[model samples]
Target chain A: MKQKRMQGNADLQKLTDLAQQLRRDTIRMIHHAGSGHIGGALGLADYMAALYGWAMQYDDLDPTDPDRDRIVLSNGHTCAVWYAALARSGLIPLEELATHRRMGSRLQGHPARKAMPEYIETSSGPLGQGFPVANGIALSLRKRVSQGRVYVILGDGELQEGQVWEAFMTSAHYKLDTICAFINYNNIQIDGKVEDIMGIAPLADKIKAFGWHVVEIDGHDTASIVAALSEAASTKGKPTAIIGNTIMAKGVPSMEGDAKWHGNTPNDAETEAALEAVGTNNRFKDFPIANRA
Target chain B: MYSGNKAMRDAFGDALADIGAQDDRIVVLTADLTDAIKVGKFKERFPERFYQMGIKESDMIGTAAGMAIDGQIPFTSTFAVFTTSLANQAIRVNVAYNNANVKIATSHGGVCVGADGATHQAFEDVALMRLIPNMTILVPCDANEAYKATIAAAKMDGPVYLRFGRIPSPVVTGADDPFEIGKARILRDGKDVAIVAMGAMVPAALEAASILAADGIKAKIVDMHTIKPLDENTIIESAKECGCVVTAEEHTVLGGLGGAVAEVLAKNLPTPLRMVGVLDTFGESGEPQEILEKYHLTYSDIVKQVRLVLKQK
Candidate 1:
């Protein structure tokens, strides 16, 4: 029991470090691109870190294997986090991270499966669309009789689209328990705070009403995120919705919880400051030189 | 080559169920129009493979695209308008952009879905689907051809829009007739003029050919079913042989089959063309035949367009 607890703690620490690196990568990618949805990407780093670093099982050599678990970024605008996770996890070449959002880059502004076919499961930038694709993936996986599960992340504002509800119903109606979706509740969208824009109040009830096994968690807590994913995989007969309450632009102290950072790239000074705040990893030293912060 | 008059939707259901039995990967998704889309047969046969997705076209499309991406050949069905226009976002991004091997087989593709009103009638489905890249648009001529097209779509990769008619139509293609994707079939040979038609309009074009034959005018009948990745070689060859072309469909004259044919001719052949379709208008609730005639989408309309194009030639 002691040894297992120690291993769990070690894994949590690694994931925490991973979350910091991912946040730094998110900032660097957006800063280099000169424009991107920074807030959501930063906010989603912890979940992405937890998922890529620990939960997801993929063949590093053959990433598109049929048995590999699918990671559907439904909130595609925050692809910087997804791209960073893929690179950091060694699933993709770390050098390719520089080409993010650049013209002709496989790392498209939105998660386009056609652009990065093996990595991205589907093209999803339109809010409320990715979850449905994830549901479909889960459904297909069931039909394929594979152990693969679909991990999807949706923006809180995305729930406003009626299509999300429709897809939510589908996951339950078909009893596609293989889908473990996370609602990146950063409380902000392109417009403003999610609640101010369109109230998705009583979110747990709404998702439960839609027939999901709801697991509310602190988005930044790697342990909680990992636990929820496992809980989702274990729970049968219905899909799980892990509502991760996160701070917008997490790990970047100056921009945390600020809706204004939702779509803005960090300036040179802001980038340096943000990099320091997130504690950049030595693995991606080429991205931002040492002592730059 | 006429087998009998049967609704194209019913034929699509039969072909879908038959295909489902052959391939375990084949799945069918419906948006509460199970019987109307004729996918009830599919649901009955492949109960596990069939998904009654409720009245959610957008979700249905996205889910279908997902399944396709994961190596399942998913055939999503609904009224043409719902999938084409209402759930167009999913079609554009998930199916087209992702290039997922999804088949959007729909019923009531044209304004001929009488009594369903303008909302259900999809006059612009072909045009909407054609605009998207990586989409293979197939408007099968009749019930028999619809079955063949469904099977063909299953064999092909990437996004396919298999548009079918709601009303019963004469079977023009025989069992032995070739039904390859992106290949147009020449129903009748002619030299004076050509009639390139798709969906419900193919039967009308065949009738027009016989009518023109009586008047000593040999109008070639071409069933240009696959609208996208269109059979340009066939269209140009036919236009070159006949000197002029008349494109017909149960859709608007603006940008459906007519527009696709016109674009091809202008770029390659630059042939004189006349389009016989709904003239930039919405359909009203009425008898399918009556509405088609009023919108100039029948045999007589094809004859009228052929004469106009022949004059230009």
Candidate 2:
């Protein structure tokens, strides 16, 4: 029992380290590209780490395997985290992370499936659109009798879009248990705080009322995310909604809880500080300067 | 209720049921309009595959795209207005951008929706659908064509918008007639004028052709159903043969069938042309036939337009 506990703790530590690496890579990619949603990307790093590194079952060699688990970034502005996660997981080349938001690059401002259809299931930029697509994928998986699950990452502000609620009702009504949604509850949107823009208070209660099994956890905690994902997998007869309580800019010290970093990229000095604060030694020591153009 | 007359929506339901039996991957989704959209047959046949989306057109569109991504052929059914206009953004990003294999089967297209008013009638579905990059727009002329188009849409990969009408119009094409995407069917052969039409206006154009024939005018009728990949070859051929063209449809003259044909003619043939359709106005609540006549979408309108074009020629 003690050995088992230690093994679990070691696994948690590995995930935590991976989450920090993802945060570092995400910050560097945004800073190098000169534009991206840094705040949400940073906030969603731990969840991405848990999903790609530990929880989700996907083939690193053949990412487009029909029975592989699918991860859909519904709030596609935080594509930095997705790209970073994909790269870190070896699903995509780590060196290609430099081309984020660049001209003729596969990594666009949003998660465009045209860029990489094999890994990215759908192109998503508009809010609340991804959730329904995830529902459809889950429904299809169910129809095929495939055990594959679909995980959709959405923003807290995206809950304001009526289509998300519609998806919520449909998934639950269809008894799509294979769908597990994670809301990055960072409380900050592009304009301002999510509450100031449009309050989706009583969010967990509302999702539960809609017939989903709801789980609220600390978004920065790797262990809690893994546990919640496991609970979601075990959950039968209904979909799961994990309300991840996360800070806006989670890992970076100066940017944490700051709404201004929601879209703005950090400069050289700020990037150096953020890299140090994220505590990952995998900093870009020889990143190509010519690729910036 | 009458012989050789059935609503395109009913044909869509029957066709879906037939196709669903053969293809297990085929799924039906409706925004709480199963009976109205006539997908009840498919629902009864494949209860598990049929999804009642409960009036949420946007969600339905995204969900259908997702299903498509998972290698399932999802046919989303709803009123034309809600499917095209209400779910425009979702269809653009989720379905069209991703090139997901989603069949948007929209019933009650154009002023044929009648007393449902301007809000319900979709006067600009073809225009809206055509604007999307990877979207295939099919405005079937009658029930037989609608059935064929639905089946073809299922067989074809990527996004397709199949537009049908609420009224029980004439079944112009028989089951044996050839039906292919982006191919125009020339129903009548003539030399004086070419009557190019789509959707509910095909029957009107055919009737107008007969009326012109009685008046010693040879008017050719072409059923240009697929609007996006506009059959420029057939339109140009008809123009070369006829010397003049009159385009007709139940949609607005601004950007529907008439606009598509005029675009092809203006660039390639530059033939004298007259358009017979709604003159950029919303339809009001009335009977289908009453509104169609009020909007000048009847055979008489097509005849008038044909005569005008022939005079210009």
Candidate 3:
């Protein structure tokens, strides 16, 4: 039993390194572009890295390989993390990460289906649309004889759209066992704090009420996220909603938990500091700093 | 009795059931209007594939996109006016953006909706959907055509807008007529003038053809159902053969079937053409036939337009 526990710990440690690499990649990609959503991107970095590295099953060589798992970014504004994870996972070239949000570059400000390969799924800039699209993909996969899962990520702010609730209701009703929703509950949006701007409190309870099986976890904790995702996969007869409790700006000291950092880019000096804080070697050197509204 | 006005909606449900049984991937979605769109039969048969989106068009579209991603061909049903306006973004973003294989089954299109006024009447649906990239716009002429179009859209590879009318016109086309998207079918050939029509106006155009023939004016009638791809070849050929044209439809004069035909003619042949449709007006509550007459959408209207365009030449 101890041996099994140690093996699990070692596996989680590898995921922790993957998360740090994803963070570094996100910061580098956004900093190079001179623009991109940084707050939510940084917050969701750990969760995304964990999913791509371990939770989700996909073939980088053939993205549209019929048997491959699907990951859709519903809150596409936070695409920095997604692009970084994709590159780090060998889905795209690691060197191409620097071209993010640059004109003539495959990477766009938001997740664009035209910009990237077929793996990007669909163009998702306007909020509240991706969730339903993701639901449709999930439902379709469930209909096929082959088993494939669809993972969708959304920001807490994007939840304000009534469409999310509508999708949630339909997902539960259909009992789409193959669909899993990840909510970056980072408590921030473009205007201000999510609570002050649009009180979507009791979000978890609301999802539960809509008949989805809810799983709450730490967004920055790679182990907790992976564990929660596993629990969601094991959940049968209904769709799963994993609410990832996260800090808005996550790593950098000045921007941590600040709503102003949502779309704001850091100065060169600040970027250096942020990179140093996450660690220079691209492995998690410090635990997540817990700060709440 | 649901009235003759509700036959298209009823046909939509019947065809969905007929098609759904043969294809397992055929899923149905509604924005709280399954019964209104007359999708109850399919829903009852395949409860597993039926989804009630509860009046949210945008979300319903997004969910349909998701379903499409998973390899299910989703048919989202709703009133044409509501779907076109409320769910425009969904169609653009979800279906068009990814080029997802989703069918937008829209009923109660145009002034034939009657009694519900302009709000229920869908005049600009064709125009709006036509603007989207990779979208196949299909306006079926009747119940028989609607069923054939539904099946054809299911087999097609991308996003399709299957526009159906509220009232049941004559079943002009044979039950076995194979409906093809982006291709115009010639109903009757003539040597003097060509009448290009779509949706509920095809029967009117056919009647106008007979009236013109009696008056020593040989008329050609073409069902230009797939308006987006506009059947440029057929329109150009018809223009070359007939010399004058009359385009008719149950939509707005702006960017509907007539506009599509005019664009093809203006750029290709520049032949004298007259349009027969709603001219910058909103519809009002009345019976379907009363509204059709009030909008000048009858055999007599087509004949008048044909003579006027003939005089212009």
| Top candidate, metric lDDT | 2
Q: DockQ numbers for every candidate?
A: 0.86, 0.86, 0.62
lDDT per residue (tens digit) for residues B1-313 in model 2 = 1238888888888899999999999999999998999999999989989988888999999999999999999999999989888999999999999999999999889887788799998888888888899999999999898888999999999899999988898988888899999999999999999999999899998899888899999988999989978889999999999999998988888888888888998999899989988898988999999998888889999898887878798
Encode model 2's per-residue lDDT on A147-189: one tens digit a residue. Answer: 8889999999999999899999999999999899999998898
**Model 3 ranges with Cα > 4 A deviation:** A1-10, A65-67, A103-105, A114-118, A145-147, A282-293, B1-14, B176-178
lDDT of 3 by residue, A47-145 (tens): 877777777667765677665677788898898888878877777877777777877877888887767646787778788788777777776766665
Model 2 stretches with alpha carbons more than 4 Å out: A1-10, A282-293, B1-3
Q: First chain TM-score in every candidate?
A: 0.93, 0.93, 0.91
Assign candidate 2 its CAPRI class.
high
Better of 2 and 3 by lDDT: 2
Ranking by TM-score: 2, 1, 3
Candidate 1, superposed: residue stretches over 4 Å from native: A1-10, A280-293
Residue A30 of candidate 3: its Cα lDDT?
Answer: 72
Choose 1 or 3, whichever is better by DockQ.
Answer: 1
**Model 3 chain B poorest ten-residue lDDT run:** B1-10
Candidate 3 residue pairs that clash: A132-B62, A132-B63, A133-B62, A133-B66, A136-B66, A136-B67, A137-B66, A137-B67, A137-B70, B115-B286
True interface contacts retained by model 3:
0.90
Candidate 1 structure quality by residue, lDDT tens digits, A1-293: 00111123328888888888888778888888788999999999888877777777776777777877788988889899899988887777787878888899988899888777888999889889898899888888888789887888899999999988888889888888888889988788778888899899899999999889999999999888888877887899998999999999988889998888988778899988998887756644645423333
Clashes of each: 0, 0, 10
